[model samples]
Target: MMAEKEVQLPILRSVYQDLTRSEQRIADYITSHADEIMDKTIPELARNTKSAEITISRFCKKLGFSGLQGLKIALAAELSSSGDDRFQDIHRGDSYEQVAGKIFGNIAEGMQDTLKILDYAAVERAINALVQARRVAVYGFGNSATVCRDIETRFLRFGMVVQAYDDISQQLTSASLLTAEDVVIAVSHSGSTMNLLKTVEVAKKSGAKIIVITSYAQSNLAKIGDIVLTGMGREVHYRSESVASRLIHMAITDVLYTGIAMQQPEQYQENIGKMRSVISATRE
Candidate 1:
């Protein structure tokens, strides 16, 4: 397996069809006036797009940032690479302060939007699967590969033996040792990562139950897995939510982790209190 830092981030193809009409319009607008919109604050951007702030935040999350700051970083990143201001006019008429509310609005909406389609049953079922697994191999690549790593840590709290493999070879080797006794969870927004798909195929061939978490259940990666959980929507280049996709993914993780913890009520309560204590201490 290649070193973690050496792993390449997959270049995502435009999942444009996955977006709603308004989101598509926003995306088109961004693409058309990339130089102009990059300069606007969240509210200004919202005004230009004729979308609410909430919608804008959700739009940013879809592209994988946590909040507006992240979106700006992405824009800055875009600018750093292109050395051009693509957002000259998108928020041209607005003041920085007026744009802030819409920015918050976009973030608030992104949070709600992600939860709107979350699959509760699948989360429970995944918990049950994890609770029973002898071992698990989590997979994804590029931007999503780390989420698999994050999920691995979540499984560890329940005391399940887990491994997250991003390399094609390591994942294949891990699959060779599995049986129906194990579970494999794969995450990809596009569900088309070749490395991810290959390992999933290997695990399936080895009689393991495969679970796929992605944005599109209709994707090939979702089809191969025995169970699929979807958590994605339209792309509007909104940049309001900053990083809503990770928030949504984190929420899904939160639910799955809670469901697993709840399976043992006493442990769940104890763990919750302990967790709260730690968090409370951090508040100081």
Candidate 2:
């Protein structure tokens, strides 16, 4: 299947809270009147939003566009793209089967969207960092903590020295100790979690590589990321705060794990065999 064209509306939505007052005003106008954006020139947009042309241009650049024209092009592409919203809301008195189908369908579409936006080069950089790092640390809180633990579980099988931290203090402490030879995988769905951002900032100052797995490519955490893996999972009415994004993040973890294994097949195989034997013995 062909990948969908890159969409910018979601990026605006994700970063809306982080934008400055003037930028937010521009975003509000563009997002609310997306269909009319193409027909208007830069001056018209600026005048309509009650902002200067330069402010609008700056806003576009902040969202990773070159200028207003680039933003318009992206808006046009998104407007013309063909796709229906797959995430259905869970209404009261809905049948069990109907609810099940809706949930499953949304998750499937979310994954598909992730695959479409998944940057292979970024994935390769992350895998290389993980493989070569003297130590690896993962940071996540709330829903993202599960993905962090999954990272630890998968990398440990490959005999990699990795730890996952869910607590803010622990995350900060771990970040402070990381060296140039270390890597940090920071997971966040919103990508704007203040505590996680602070921890990642510490990790950044320690000269360790930061690999951010988040849905927002332009988030503050992503700005600090040496390698950014973007996932596209929209917040639906039923699944508030990106509950669906956790699964998408976990899928990314699996991709990284498989890639790391491929880099050294025989060594990974040997480690897997040893780990499986010891764990099997413990289970029974």
Candidate 3:
């Protein structure tokens, strides 16, 4: 039996299972052009196979990929020598909009990678612990600080007492002060921020709940975390915000927030009102 993490191509699930004629045709085309399809556009592939765009999309989803684009991208990676680019050419001749869209695409891919490596049972345990924690502390450095602030702001609506630490001294101080009943969510893309990890260590020995969100495996942060959520990337380009890594972190945060909300309905509603009250007052 294949593990969930090992299951990449959904299309290979069953040879005898039902498939629409159009889907079968599209799948055949993918198998034929498995080499060139990696960089092919949706319109181009559809045209080549005489298949409609929607049919191709459904075929991809039927195979377990989120869309046709994802399936092709994966297949392309398989054919390419390295399937990894240390640098991106998309920035060379692109407009700002083009750059922005490409960045978003990267983030989406990064998030998907993170999801693939994540342990759902850990997320569940973290969510339960957080919901019952006496307080929550969030810490980060650089762009990660923004992610920390964002998650903290959302967590506050549940009326959970939340704090964000940006300064090392302050974070350390707070970490030392936290009790076993408190939860700390630390954010770092590289997962190697010395200050953040130090703070996490302090929190750890103190018995505080530790959730580590980062982009590296075998990372020290991952080693200490009670829960490690990854943000993945490829070569050719270092993990840049304009591409996949940022979106991956953004997705993980959103998923955690959504889980918290769904796990505690009354608390979620109360948190919603806290945001609404500010808008209501602004209108007044």
Candidate 4:
């Protein structure tokens, strides 16, 4: 449950088992001497680790760094911190109060980091795409599908045409019908979901602009996206059970929703009033 900002060591550890032998060696050397790694050039580190410079660069990208310098800068920042105690992972014997504090602290930290790294320009671009599109189709599976449904509900309130699909068959059918005037918001934390990728491919063929929300900047999903918004957070040990990612996803969705609302305030207000009146009548 470490804060996303202090991600250098945690990211390496999180994906260590998936790294190649050479990458593992590089990761080991860097983690052990993180402070010094910043001072050394990529070639120098390559020599030290007996890895080629290209290998070092590839390893950095695998961890979502732009290059060696980016990796070094992140490492330096993480190593300088004494580590936030509240963000520590939960223990077996922790009290309920301790668990609550840790969970809240971790979520807060992740949101802060996500905000810090968010590309406002890209967000604006995404908003523009959504606003200009003839239709907006949201695609996601599992927990991400819940996020997609939330987005659909928000856009629907604005009187916009939006559809969210949780089933792969329905997603493919919806995607196949999209055109260049449409926009697709594909939500996948890992960005490697094959089913989502397949749907995206079909959508792309019809010239739909893709907006991907994921944690990995260099993931396959990002590669295909017209605008890629990165969600900052490391999935804890019980990744499937973690709420941190869902929180981050909702935060990003909030930004987009507000952006669209602000762009057309008069229409948004009118739609909101109508929706409220209709819902209130149901309650009565």
Question: What TM-score fits each model?
Answer: 0.59, 0.82, 0.65, 0.84
Over 172-205, each residue of candidate 4 has an lDDT whose tens digit, in order, gives 9999999999999999877889999999999999
lDDT of 3 by residue, 134-197 (tens): 9999999888888888888877777789989899999999999999999999888767788888
By lDDT rank, best first, the candidates go 2, 4, 3, 1
Task: Arrange candidates by TM-score, descending.
Answer: 4, 2, 3, 1
Whole-structure CA lDDT of model 4: 0.82
Off by over 4 Å in 1: 1-104, 233-243, 268-284
Candidate 2 lDDT over 81-105, as tens digits, reads 6255544778878899988888888
Off by over 4 Å in 2: 1-8, 115-120, 277-284
Which one wins on TM-score? 4
The C-alpha RMSD in Å for every predicted model, in order, reads 14.7, 4.6, 13.3, 4.1
TM-score of model 3 (CA atoms): 0.65
Candidate 4: 10-residue stretch with minimal lDDT: 1-10
Q: Which portions of model 3 miss their true places by more than 4 Å?
A: 1-88, 233-244
Candidate 2 local accuracy as lDDT? 0.84
Total backbone collisions, model 2: 0
State the TM-score for model 1.
Answer: 0.59
Which tens-of-lDDT digit does each residue in 127-208 have in candidate 1? Answer: 8888888888888776677788888877776657887888888988998889999999887877877878888898899999
Cα-based lDDT at residue 241, candidate 3: 42
